[model samples]
Target: MEPRWLSQDEQESWLPFAAMLIKLPAALDAQLQRDADITHFEYLVLARLSMIRDRTLRMSELASVVSASLSRLSHVVKRLEQRGWVRRAPCPENGRFTNAILTEAGWEKVVATAPGHVEEVRRLVVDALSESELRQLREISSRVLQRIDPDAGTW
Candidate 1:
């Protein structure tokens, strides 16, 4: 079956959204690299670890939460390990699995970087939207995400 082309209105709306999807991550990555000496994905991985109990999470779980492939996560984890920001140890309950544990230095680094990251996020996104528009955008985004990944609800 042939795919239906977008209508003019759809194209107009999608253009900016598509541009945002491409540009926003790049901008965030650039800011993080400059300010934190880490890529945005690394920040995300660390941030996710920060949020977990004991500042530790299984590799697979971390990969899922960060939307990263295991191999990609492994490489990033290795980098973090080299920096003494993260450590890997055999899971206590399951020896076959490994857990990523955030070090004190990692926690401190993320804590220091968070305010700047939050400021950047606000500057780039939140501050531009009205309260009602932000709510509406959240709802729309949730629906779109659900449609894109049915299993995403587990997160």
Candidate 2:
């Protein structure tokens, strides 16, 4: 079957979106690296772990939450472990499972870094949009995410 080419308007919109996909992660990583000595992905993992009950989450659950493969998460977790930021323990309920727990030091690091990260987010994305535009952007993004991953589970 022949593919339908994008219209000019779609092309223009997609170009910026594609560029953003490529650039945003790099930019975010750079900022985190400068301020926290961590990659954006590592910060994300740490941040997610921080939010979970008991400041811990099962490895598989963490992988799913971060949309990362087990192997990928393992490597990242290993690095975090080295930094004294996280530790892995055998899950109490299931010996076969492991849980990633954010350490006190890790929590402190995240707490210290969060303000800078939030400022970066505001400066880079939020501040660029008007109040109405921000709302519309959130609605659009939520709809697109739901369509892309219908069974993505809870927010």
Name the top lDDT candidate.
1
Report the lDDT of model 1 for residue 111: 98
Worst 10 residues of 1 by lDDT: 146-155
Q: In angstroms, what RMSD does candidate 1 have relative to the true structure?
A: 1.2
Q: Which regions of candidate 1 deviate over 4 angstroms?
A: 1-3
For model 2, the superposed segments whose C-alpha errors exceed 4 Å read 153-155
What do the candidate models score in CA lDDT, each in turn?
A: 0.94, 0.93
RMSD of 2: 1.5
Q: Give the total clashing residue pairs for model 2.
A: 0
Candidate 2 lDDT for residue 134: 98
